[model samples]
Target: MPRTDTASRVITAPLDRVWDALVDPAALAVWLPPAGMTGRFERFDARPGGSYRLVLTYADASGAPGKATADSDIVEARFVDIVPGVRVVQAVDFVSDDPANAGTMTMTWQVTAVAAGTRVDIVATDVPDGITAEDHAEGLASSLANLAAHTER
Candidate 1:
C-alpha cells in the first residue's frame, strides 16, 4: 500500500489572497521550499491538465555553503483539479534515477475562509516508500508555513 499524509495550517491572509499566491508561478517560487532550502519554478500552469516543474536546493543552517551532499530535488507536477479560491489538487512525481522513489503521488490542497484567516488543508496520497510519513508531514507543514509568511507579507 502507498503512504498517505495530511496536514493543515491557517494563514493570516484572506482566502482570495492566499489563492492567488498559491496559483501564481512567480509567487510559488517565493514560498514553496521547506526550511533551509530555496526553490525555483521552471514552468507553472495553474489550470486543470496543465503542468509545472520546480527545483529545490538545500543549504546549511548558517546559510553558508557546503556540508549537505544531496544538493537538490526536482519535482514535476500536473494540476488535476482547481477551484478558484477554493481548492487545488495535483499529481506529483520526482525526477530520480532511484527505483525506490519511482511513483506518482496525488496531493490535494483545500483553501477555505475562516474566522482567523484562511485554512489550508493538504492531503497527499500514494506516497513512495522512500519518503517517510513524518518527513513528508514536516515538509507539508513547512510549506504551509512558508505560504503563510508569504501571504502575510
Candidate 2:
C-alpha cells in the first residue's frame, strides 16, 4: 500500500483558534516546526493556487535528525484547498539532490469541534522515500504539540 502517515489530537483551543494557527503565518512560524527544528516561511500566500516556501533548520549543530542527516529541509508548497476553520490541503515538493526524495507530496490538515476542544488531524501522502514514516510521524506530532502549547497560553 502507498504510504500515508496520519496523526490526530484534541487540542484545548477552539476551532477558530486552531484555524487561525493554520492560516496565520506568525502563529504557524511558532508551532509548525518539529521539536529541534525551527520554521520560517519564505513566502506564504494562503489562498488556493497560491504557493509557499518553508525552511526547516536544525536547532542544534548535530547533523542526525531522527532518521535523516541534513541540516535543513526546504519545501516548495502550493495551497491545494483551504476551508477556513475546517480544512487545508497542501501540495509540497522538497528540494533535494537525492532521487528517492524527489517527489511531490500532499499534506492535509483538518479541524473539527469536539466536546473538550478542537480535534486536529493531519495526513501526509506520498511521503519522500528519503524520510521514514516514523520520522515524519514524530515531526508531525511535535508540531501538533507545539501548536497545543502555543494556543493554550
Candidate 3:
C-alpha cells in the first residue's frame, strides 16, 4: 500500500511572506532541497495545470544511487491547485527507471496564521515505496527549516 508522510513548522514570518516564498521559483530553488542536497529548476510554472521540473543533486554520493541517477533525483511535478496564501497542491512523480519509485505522489502545502507567525504544514501522499519513512521525514523537516530561514529573512 502507498504511504503518507507529514511535517509542519511554525515560521516566524508573516503569512504573506511565507506564501510568496512558496510560489517564487528562485526561493524554492534555495529552500526546497534537503540538508545534503542542492536543487535547480529546469522549468517552472506556478499556475494550476502548469508544471515544473526540479533536479536535486546530492552533495555526497557515497550511499545508494539516487532515484534518477547516481547522484540526482529528478522530479516532474504539476500544479494541481493553488489557493493564494492558503495552500498549494502538486502532483509529483520521480523520473526514474526503478519500478519501486514509479508512481504519482500528491503533495500539499498549507499555511495558517498563528500567534507567533505562520504555521506551514506539508503532507505527501501515495509516496513511492523506494522512499523510506524516516528519510522522507528528515527531508520534510529539512525543507521546512530551509523555508523558515528563507522567509524569515
The best candidate by TM-score is: 3
Once fitted onto the true fold, the runs of candidate 3 whose alpha carbons sit more than 4 angstroms away are none
Best model number under lDDT: 3
Tens-digit lDDT string for candidate 1 (1-153): 688899999888999999998898888888888887888988888899999988888765344221122577788899999999889999999887776677999999999999999999999999987777887888888999999988986
Q: Could you tell me how far off, in angstroms, the CA of residue 16 lies in candidate 1 after the best superposition?
A: 0.4
Model 3 alpha-carbon miss at residue 39, Å = 0.6
Better of 2 and 3 by lDDT: 3
Comparison by lDDT, 1 against 2, better one: 2
Q: Candidate 2's error at 20, in angstroms?
A: 0.3
TM-score for predicted model 2 compared with the true structure: 0.93
Which 10 successive residues of model 2 have the least lDDT summed?
Answer: 61-70
Pairs that collide in candidate 1 are none
Every model's TM-score: 0.90, 0.93, 0.98
List, residue by residue over 28-93, the lDDT tens digit for candidate 3. 999999998999999999999999999999999787578999999999999999999999999999
List model 2 lDDT by residue over 1-153, tens digit each: 347899999999888988999998889989998888888898999999998888888877475542224577788899999998899999989887777777888999999999989999999998888778887888899999999998775
RMSD of each: 3.3, 2.2, 0.7
